[model samples]
Target: MRTLPSTGPRYEPPRPGSNGASPFLPPLPSSRTPIDPPDPIEPVEPIEVEPPPEPERRKLRVVDVQDRASLGGAALAGLSLTWVLYSRILPTEGTLGFIVCWWLSFTAFYLLLTGLRRGRVVLADRFAVLLAHSGAALVGIALATVIGYTLIRGAPALMHWNFFSQDLRTAGPLEPLSTGGALHALAGTLIQITMAIAVTLPLGVLCAVYLTEVGGRASRLVRSVVEAMTALPSIVAGLFAYVVLLISFGMRLSGFVAAMAISVMMLPIIARSSEVVLRLVPSGLREASLALGATQWRTVWSVVLPTARPGLATALVLGTARGIGETSPVLLTAGYTTYLNLNPFSGPMTSLPLFTFKMSQSPENNYISRAFGAAALLLVLVLLLFAFSRWLAGRGRSGAR
Candidate 1:
């Protein structure tokens, strides 16, 4: 390569300690540069943040004052409108018709007011509540009226002490209320029901057990038959008993035969109800029992039966209620009699239902009073049975605890 000629004087780097320092020399401190103290770290006080204010608590209440006010307003409006329509606009009406119209108007006005004040959700809820309350109220009113009317109509006969002590054997349709009592009818009813319960309870519970614990094709068949029997009319049951025992076997009408007829009605009811109750028993219990090496029979008898005792009592009550009020079967099988017959195996028996029916057919006021009195007694008996069942159920619950 050939050298080229320079254009000007050549550049030279400065020596060490001169205007610039050499790269090999160590760095030197400068007095002009200020040295600041390290930043002072002031202690930060803990943040004194107050806890968020506790939310105000409000107690929830059912049926507030506003609800009561709204209800009163609706009732007043409904009653006023009903009175105006019935008295001024309508041609004629009875108490029942006016009451029904007032109820309809009240419900409509209440729903309208609720929808206006609240929204659709609240309106729907209020409507549902109102419907439930109205249905319960109507049921209560109907029961009260029936009981009140029955007691009022039967007061003349019920007030007499002898009406419960004597039988209709010495009494006539024209006889005074004090002359005779429903002793025979009462005895017959008690005896028949007792016998029916005795015959049906064990069999029904066993059938239920078989259906629940030993379910098979046979169980399904039995269940079908039981369901069919539940719909069997009282008259059909009566007719069957009349045909089989009376016609075929030459068995005479007696309380025993009446009990047999009643059993036909009671058996299916008890079985079906017991089956439902048994099905409600937890499978866990059965598994636990089996795990403990208890046999199936022992588990059912000791564990299952005791656990379902209260429900079984309920089943008993149901069967008793169905059988006790049966008139057609008793009339067909027992052949009603006015005279008191203590022996159920031999003679005709007079039950409360039969006595009520017979007395109601008579034209005499005294007879009608007796009929009503008998009917009232039947109601009392049913109440007693219900109370007894509840007592038994409560006892079982306490025992379990």
Candidate 2:
């Protein structure tokens, strides 16, 4: 029998025949080796990859020097053109017209210069961004101007010590700045605002809790009413207080009535704002508290309300601010007075807004100055409260649920 060639899987060289060169038909070349399969590839170890570099932080100066130069040129041209138009072309120097002129000139120049340097797409983007930033800056500038002007006009009255220590009862409208202060008005405002807060906070907070935590179909109607009340005019609130307390009932127009009117204005604001804040608390927090066997009210009181404390404070402050600056409600309910009245129930009392309004209407320069001073004080107080509220919000931001 003929033996079969070795059937092993590994590659092997062809066997030589009985005689040399007799195995295959072709003869091998002298310098060539017989064909063989390539050697098996060795297994490779895994590669170690280097970590990527961190990205560089961007600089705050988004605008380049070229852009700044363009802006400067636009400003110079705008101011010059505004001056010429205001001085020579206009019939009056109430240069509000000049403001429009300057803005138009600046916009025209800015677009022209930017379009030339950059392509149209880039120019459009830059113009839009700059316009928005410029608008915001303009608002800031206007606010600063108002505050500064009020301070400058009221400097004489504010500098006097009697403005704080005494009341308008003894000081005539024509009297010198040193003789009288808005002490009574200031005191009345504080007391009335305090009373309003006393009435509004518990009710507002509870209403918010109901809307956010225990909401039902009735909550929708309540929410709609609150939203509508937010836009309710100050005069309407005043009229409601007047009709309810003075005309319908037998109550006098006193500081308590004023407080009630302010309470009306403040209540919806606080409740709506508090609802927003409470909704911002995470669902996970309530779930976690309840998961731990805490009751619903306990979860709200311990987990939700505490987490939202700062925001609630901010809402309260915002409501107080809205009521504090109001004039119409105080006018109808408080019946402006100059004398210091410690009791909210007994007699007519003045507030800062009322005092300022009465003083501004007078023909005397001293009265106008006093009005401006009171306005400045009000502005300063509002700004301080706003800043404080912002601080509270920021402090609790990291811990918010």
In the range 19-103, model 1's lDDT, one tens digit per residue, is 4766667746555543454454455545556777889888665567777788889999999999999867989689989999999
Model 1 per-residue lDDT at 119: 82
TM-score, structure 2 vs. true: 0.78
User: Which candidate leads the pack in TM-score?
Assistant: 2
Tens digits of per-residue lDDT for model 2 on 1-401?
A: 33333333666576655337776667555565668876754444445566677689888765799899998898888788778877677765766777877888888888888888889887888789878998999999998899899889878888998998889877886789989898898899899999999999999999999999999999999999999999989999999999999999879979999999999988999999999999999999999999999999999999999988999999998888888899999999998888988899989999999999999999999999999988888877788889988998888886653
Worst 10 residues of 1 by lDDT: 1-10
The global C-alpha lDDT for each of the candidates, from Candidate 1 onward, is 0.87, 0.88
TM-score of each: 0.77, 0.78
Which residues of candidate 2, in runs, are more than 4 Å off? Answer: 1-67, 77-103
Global Cα lDDT for candidate 2 = 0.88
The 10-residue segment of model 2 with minimum total lDDT is 1-10
Q: What are the clashing pairs of model 2? A: none
